[model samples]
Target: MFESVMWLIVVAGGPLLLALLMAYVLMTRRHRGPAERMESDRATKRLYSQDER
Candidate 1:
């Protein structure tokens, strides 16, 4: 009985979790503009610069 209940939760929750993650990814991609993304990428590259030494 306990095993069956755990299996039921896993089956239902897995898809729900995947759907939420997909929605989050889509929303974030839509929210950021191209210029904003470029600036973020530049900032990240500057932060990790190996020539600073």
Candidate 2:
């Protein structure tokens, strides 16, 4: 009985631990910032005309 319970725990915990590891990896991935902030990041929220050329 004890050995069976331990085997069950190992089987169940393996997938659970894998899921948590995957979740952690996905949540920590780098993401793009807000669109407005990215647009205004250069000079005072304005894109320079000369910089365009």
Candidate 3:
């Protein structure tokens, strides 16, 4: 009985957790625009130096 209850929780919670994660990732993804593009470019450049391959 205890094992069945735990299994059900895992089955239900796994999809619920996955859906929430997907929603968060989709919602927070970068938006397209000149300003946003420039900021993103700058961030990438700052993080990865062009001099190194």
Candidate 4:
């Protein structure tokens, strides 16, 4: 009985814990600021412009 209970906890709780952890990480992540975004856009544009040459 104890082994069965442990198995149940491991099977159910493992995914639950992983999902909660993933949610927390996704929710708490910081987005890039405007200056960083502009720099990224410029770099992308530069790369594409070079490809057109």
Candidate 5:
């Protein structure tokens, strides 16, 4: 039936979609190490500043 085929497509594509998302995140993160670290440091600074205000 059409519903079964649609369900099969959804089930079959789930892992492939997840793998693609993981790969994309990993690839982008490889070039963003310094930027991500800086963001974390800035966030920490803001947290401490807010406490002092």
Candidate 6:
């Protein structure tokens, strides 16, 4: 019974942990300042432009 309960907790916690991590990432990303966002955008554009060569 103890092992079964542990297994169930682990199974339920996996998705909960993943969801928390994803939410944290999304919240941080959404709160970036304009300059920081612009820098990220510029970096992405630079990377893609280099890839086209």
Report clashes for each candidate as comma-separated counts.
0, 0, 0, 0, 0, 0
User: lDDT tens digits, residues 1-53, model 2?
Assistant: 99999999999999999999999999999876798666667555355666676
Query: Which ranges in model 6 have alpha carbons more than 4 Å from their true place?
Result: 30-53
Candidate 5 regions off by >4 Å?
31-53
lDDT of 5 at 6: 92
TM-scores for every candidate against the unseen true structure:
0.51, 0.53, 0.57, 0.70, 0.50, 0.54
Question: Can you write out model 3's per-residue Cα lDDT over 1-53, one digit (the tens) per residue?
Answer: 99999999999999999999999999999779999999999989977886566
| Residue 29 lDDT in candidate 2 | 96
Model 1 misses residue 35 by how many Å?
Answer: 6.0
lDDT of 4 by residue, 1-53 (tens): 99999999999999999999999999999999999999999999999999999
lDDT of 5 by residue, 10-52 (tens): 9988988999999999888755588899998999999999999
lDDT ranking from best to worst? 4, 6, 3, 5, 1, 2
What C-alpha lDDT do the candidate models reach, one value each? 0.91, 0.83, 0.93, 1.00, 0.91, 0.94
Q: Model 2 has how many clashing residue pairs? A: 0
Best by lDDT: 4
**For candidate 1, lDDT tens digit of each residue in 1-53?**
99999998899989999999999998888567899999999998988895575
lDDT of 6 by residue, 1-53 (tens): 99999999899999999999999998888577999999999999999999999
For this target, which candidate reaches the highest TM-score against the unseen true structure?
4
**Model 4, residue 31: displacement in angstroms?**
0.6
TM-score ranking, high to low: 4, 3, 6, 2, 1, 5
User: Each candidate: RMSD to true structure?
Assistant: 4.0, 7.1, 3.9, 1.8, 3.6, 3.9
Model 2 spans > 4 angstroms off:
32-53
Global fold similarity of model 4 (TM-score): 0.70
